[model samples]
Target chain A: MTGNVRLTQVARRWDAIIIGSGAGGGVVAWSLAFQGMEVLVIERGHHVPFSPPDRDHLRNHRLTQYGHNVGPSLDDRRGMTTGDDPTSATWHSPLEWQYNNNAMGVGGGTSVYGAQAWRFKPEDFRMASIYGVPEGSSLADWPISYADLEPHYIEMERELGVAGGRGGTQTWPMPPTAPTVKGQRLAAAAGRLGWDTQAVPLAVNSVPYNDRPACVNCQHCVGFACPVDAKNGSQNTFLPRAMETGNVTLITDAQVVHIESAGEKVTGVRVVQRGKSMVIPTDRVIVAAGAIETARLLLVSQIGNQNDQVGRNLQGHYYASAAGITPESVYDGVGPGPSVATTRWSHGNDGIIGGGMLADDFVLLPIIYAKRALPPHAPTWGDEWKNFVRDNYRRTLQVMGPIQDIPSPTSRVLVSPTETDAVGMPRVVLSGTAHPESVRAQTFLLGKAKQWLAEAGAEQIWGSPSGQYLSAGQHQAGTCRMGEDPRTSVVDPSGKIHGYANIWVADTSVHVTNGGFNPFLTAMATAIRTSSLIS
Target chain B: MPIDAHLVPILRAATARIVPTDDLPGAAELRATEFILGFPEYADSYNAGLAKLPADFDLSTPDAQDSALSQLSSDDPHFFDLLRRQTIEAVLAQPSALWDAMGFVVTA
Candidate 1:
């Protein structure tokens, strides 16, 4: 049932009122529902669009023209910050602060994400202990280690029918999809450069598995809904399983306004269903509405901020790229790209506190690709510009990496006390940037990417730059960090709020350091781990 | 005359300068002026951005337009940024011919 509408009065209170039915909430919902617990999942956006993203090229998740591909109308939603206006002069410039571009449908970001599922390495957990803390960084060891979460990672992979092994070094439930033209080129290049390359683990199918079809190599993989339902996400996997258990009721388009809490215990949630507002009662509450919204909700509810640590420690991976026009056409319309990667550079770089995973570019939307891959000297709208794109479109290759970022308390999500959204909730405000060390590492990673692309036959190399701005794009994470110390974290090692036992946070918000790779799989593992300890 | 009659020439004049035609038709000729001003709010924003242009400055020539708009970019960049993005988005989204000319195939 979709929400933000008239509410049906229910006398029965739910066992768990899970917020944001994306990767995090979806995992928890399935786990508890399998145990026969009655769970209700509330989503701020509608269900995924029934049609494939091929329905509209001008408007989709990747393009984000007028509205969301699977979310509410864009005009209906407003935030205090516009975006990370990279081209703007000032840090808080109006042009650079688009605060809410995240997909918010029944599946959350997973519905339209390029599902590059990855597990964090052992070194990611003990950053402070191993490398020592850099200046102005809130770098610290995670309360839980990689070993503690490895089992859950494997479980999510199997449940989601994830493809790709450690390229023969490790094993998976299913094998990796065969390399595409670009992937094969990148792998060959990495070998020539003496760097190791492996097929990236994808939450997309290789062969037909668990009743889902194999990927057909449609290039619309990055930001479009799969027509065949092959791309595995919580929307297709966990959410369905949870509902099949007959213990979970999904309420879509239900924007959570506030938490009705009596001291540390959350009594229920105030929701705006359609246009009317009502309170849905629950015994326990789980907040999984991404890092920014999760922190914003906690701030508005005034429950988890008892120690003043609720919305702090905001961070995400800063992705930088090195794109160049290759000598030959590499684009064959294959899907969900940058299909090959090298985790060998994910860590263990000298003088660099952290490194990143480098991969080829994703299959891009046309306009976005044209806008991004233009040459420096070409005119913006002249014959030269049109000519350049025509000549170089297929020959272009972009090797990029989502470099791990350092955290600071200042890089945070705050509610604008003065500004309010349409539903009368305080608008979400984002400020701060990546740590200087992280920025420096991004520069280093861009050089590494340039090397890989050049070895792969890139002739005219023009690299994309990274900034020190707060990163909460598709791979956003780290806010509402989990730790043993209440002073430094909002949730405990088990994902319980510092003070309350019934309240839990199970998203990338719990990530201490969002690793060099994509974060959805890690977020799911954390969600599963949190659910196991939720009794 | 779509949303605002007063805004159309200004959009055509300004977007032509932003995306002037040298070999192929410029943004205005390619109907990108219609595209950059596709959204009502974006059109309004583009008009507001153009309000900062120097009086008596020629919108006819590329040099004159670039010189005039460059001065206001750092001072009031939000509007300029919106205009830049909207204009580029409009041009890039123009048609199959544009992609075909560029040899780029946008398909499902």
Candidate 2:
């Protein structure tokens, strides 16, 4: 039988119904389905095709000036506002930068992500304890510590077949891929500056493991699907394993509009699929629709918010980057160019509240180089621009990091008062800016990135500091933040919604403070930990 | 057709300014007009923007053409934004010669 459920199966009562088929939802499906619980996974977007290798230079996730290879469709719109006035909101398509879209296919951002599977630094969980919360910031310590999630991190790493250097007491499943030319150059630079550098923890394969082939080292890695089927994601790993157990069924192109409730517990989910609506009964309902949509779902359902804390503290990484040119060619036409990282600056800096890991950047497609990595003073049009790109394409090197943003209660997601999506459900309204401290932290990382580039014998360096807008994009988190007290948070430490018994949130929505590194591994580890506690 | 037959020359001329041919072929040789033709949503904008241009825009000198395109940027920035963005992307997308010229290696 096919793993994709039929219309008849949609009416059957399931043991659990998980909304979203992302990093969190996929792991939850595996954990519960292996225990013989009949699970139903509802994904809003269909699976992106891996074959034929969609290498659309303009339309992929990174350079979305035209469109995206995977999508929430152009019609899937949201409103972004500045103040409390809803009338002043600007409606944005999913393709627009202002919308802050995470990919919406079967595996969500995991499908198109670079898969930098980083474990949050030990100090990351105790942010407010180590460094006092800055004024006008909502930064706080997590209810759970890194020590509590360590085992789950190991399990998830093994599950995703992570290839990286060993950290404290844990070994990666596969040996790290040989360092890229840029990675080696930057690692030497870090050593000279008296900072430690290591192989970036990647979920992509280095050898033929778990039936997938080794990476072919193509340039089109981060934004496009892997041409070699080597990049491990929830779609290629946990979801398939969950399906193999024969206890889970996935329904694609099905949007969960609301979680139905009777008294105190969620009884079922109301899904809109292909213009038709249906109710699928479940004993437990897990909301994993990323950060923005997860809050919108809870708001639409009008549950888990007795204290009005369902959609506050929205956060995404504020990336700081610097690019420069070396005398020799650093580009070896290697795939997945980000192979080295330094976590020495993740915490314990002089005056910064929380810092971030610095790493070499991904392989820049020509279009991306033109738009993002090009120096500000460089010519935009005509022959000089063309000549500059041709000459410097092989010599450019960039260092970047995701600054651990200081969370603010005002930077939030809300169900729009007026705008509705194609299914007539209220669309999301994203508003507010990042905390001032977050901008300071980002600027600090920008300086560090430039130092690293300069140490590596760079001739000219240029990069802009990030401004304090709602930073949520691919690494979006902290909407339905987890806490010990229901008055200040939406979910409990175990991811259970505060007021609801059978409802929970298993995505980055429950991030108390998103870590200094990429958040996917932590999202997966947290999901595994949370699902194991579910009866 | 999404783009009018008469406007094709005008479209080509405007796109050429975005990524003009020097030693290398630019948007015009890379079929940016054909790429723009694939988007039906841009038909109205392309038509309106081309109509606002000088009647002899395609026949004008390179300096005169650049002046006309610059005028379009201020007159209707939305259309210019679309044209400028789409032309650059279309030119950058393919043609193995362009990839080789730019040192962009696309491995299978």
Best by lDDT: 2
* Model 2: CAPRI class: medium
**TM-scores, all models, native as reference:** 0.88, 0.96
Which DockQ values do the candidates obtain, in the order shown?
A: 0.34, 0.66
Write out the backbone clash pairs for model 2: none
The DockQ score of candidate 1 comes to 0.34
- Per-residue lDDT tens digits for candidate 2, residues A1-535, read 1435554567889999999999999999999999899999999888887887998887888767668887777777778887756557788877776557678888888888888999998889999999998888888999999999999998999888898867544579987766799998888888899988888888989888899998888888888888778999989999999999989889998888988998898899999888888888899998999998899999999988889787899998898899998898898878787888888888888999889999998888887787788888887666666788888888899999998889998888887778889998898888888888888888998999999999998889998886667787668899999999999999999999887789889999999999988999999999999999888
**Backbone clashes (count) for model 1:** 16
By TM-score, how accurate is candidate 1? 0.88
**What lDDT is reached at residue B87 by model 2?**
85
Instruction: List candidate 1 segments past 4 Å from native.
Output: A1-6, A9-11, A52-58, A71-98, A165-168, B1-30, B42-88
Candidate 2 error regions (>4 Å): A1-4, A85-88, A167-170, B1-5, B47-53, B63-81
